[model samples]
Target: MGEQRKVLVTGASRGIGRAICNRLHADGYAVVGIARTRPADLPEGMDFHCADLSSAEDLRGLLKKLAAQGPYHGLVNNVGLVQSDPLADVLLEDLHRAVALNLEAAILCAQALIGGMREAGFGRIVNISSRAALGKQSRTIYSATKAGVIGMTRTWALEFAAQGVTVNAVAPGPIATEFFWDANPDRDATTAKLLAAIPVGRIGEPDDVANAVAYLLDRRTGFVTGQTHFVCGGMTVGAA
Candidate 1:
C-alpha cells in the first residue's frame, strides 16, 4: 500500500470541522486538524495544531510549520466567524474579525499549502461557506465574507486547474451545532422559524456537511471543481 494522503482541516475542534476530520480519517486519510485550542474529544491518531487563525502573526507562523510538514493532499478551510448584527448597527470590529477569519484565513492557508499540491500534481480544497452568503437577515458581515469565499474558490479553481488542483465550496444551512443552540436557545422562536424554513423539515447535522466535504476530497473527484455544493436541507431551493 502507498502512504496515506494527508488532509488539513481548520476550525476542527468542534461542530462541522470535527465531523469532517472524523469522516476523512475513517475514509483512510491522515487528518491534521487546526483550531484556536485543542479539543478534549479529539480522536486518536489525528494530528492537532492550536493557533488562532484570526490573528495574522499566529496564522503565518502556523502556516510555516505546516508547510515544512509538507505534501498535504487536501485542505478544508472550515474556520469562520459569524457575527449577527443589523446593517445599521454593525460594528467595524465585527466586520474586520469576520473578514480575517472567514476570508483571509482560507486564502492564506490555501496559499501556504497549494505549492506542495502543485509540485505533487494533485490537490483538493474545500472551503466552508454558509447559506447566508446568498442573503440572510442579521448576517451582514457573515454573508459578505462567505460570498468572498465562493469567489476565491472559483478563482483558485481556474488558476490551479492546470496543476491538477480542484477548489470547491460547501455552503451549509442551519446545522444543529453548539453555536446554533447557543444563539437560539431551547428551540425558541428563532429556532422554530429556522426549522420551518427548511424544506427538509429538519435541522441539519454536522455530519451532513462532512459528507459533502468527503465527496469533494475523494481521489476520484478531481473532475468536480469550481462549484458550490449546498448542504442546506433543501433550504437553498427556496432561498436561491
Candidate 2:
C-alpha cells in the first residue's frame, strides 16, 4: 500500500463525510478529518483539523496548515448548510451563511489545496452536492450553491486533468441521516413523499453516497473527471 497516501475530508464528524473518511482510511489512506466542533471524535490514525467552514479566516488558516503538511492524494468537500425556512422567511444572514458555507468555503478550500495536488501530479477531489442542485425551486439559494459546486468540478477537471488531478461531484437525494429527520420531523409524511417519487422506494444511507465518492476519487477513475454522478435513489431521473 505504498501508493496509499493522505486524504482530507471536511465535515468529517458525521453522516456522509464520516463514512467517506472511514472508507478511505480502510482503503489504506491516512485520513485528515476536518470539523469545527467534532474533530476530537475522529478515529485513530485520522488526523484532525478544527475550523469553521463558514469563516473565511478560519478556512484560510486550516488550509495553510494542511498545505504545510505536503501533498494529499485526495480531498473531499462534504461541508454544507441550509436554513429550514421558506425562501421568504430566510434571513439575509442565513442566505449569506448558506452560500458562504456551501460554496465559498468549497472554492477556497479547493484553491488552497489544488496546487499541491497538481504538484504531486496525482490527485482526486470529490465534491458532495445535494439533489437540490439538480434544479431551482423553493430551495433555489441552497440549490444554487450546490449547483455551483458541480460547475466547479467540471471546470477544475479540465484545468487540472493534464496535471493528473481529476475533480468530480456526487449529488445525493434525501438521506436517512438523523440530522435530516430532525430537521424535518414530519417523518412519516416526508418518507412517504420521498419514496413515492423514487423508484428505489427507500431513503439513502451515508454509506451509499460514500461508496459513489470513493469510486470517482479512486486512482482507477482518473478517466472519470468532470462528471457528476447522481447518488439519489432514482430521484434525479423522476422515477419516484
Best-fitting candidate, measured by TM-score?
1
Q: Per-residue lDDT for 54-154 in model 2, tens only? A: 88998898789887878888889999885566677767777788888888888887888888888888999989888778763456667778888889889
Reference-based lDDT, each prediction: 0.90, 0.81
Q: Per-residue lDDT of 93-171 in model 1, one digit per residue for the tens?
A: 8898889999889988998999999998999999999898999888899999999999999999999999999999999
List the lowest-lDDT window of 10 residues for candidate 1: 1-10
* Candidate 2 TM-score, true structure as reference: 0.92
lDDT of 2: 0.81
Separately for all candidates shown, the number of backbone clashes (residues 3 or more apart, or on different chains) is: 0, 2
TM-score of 1: 0.96
**Candidate that scores best on lDDT:** 1
Worst 10 residues of 2 by lDDT: 182-191
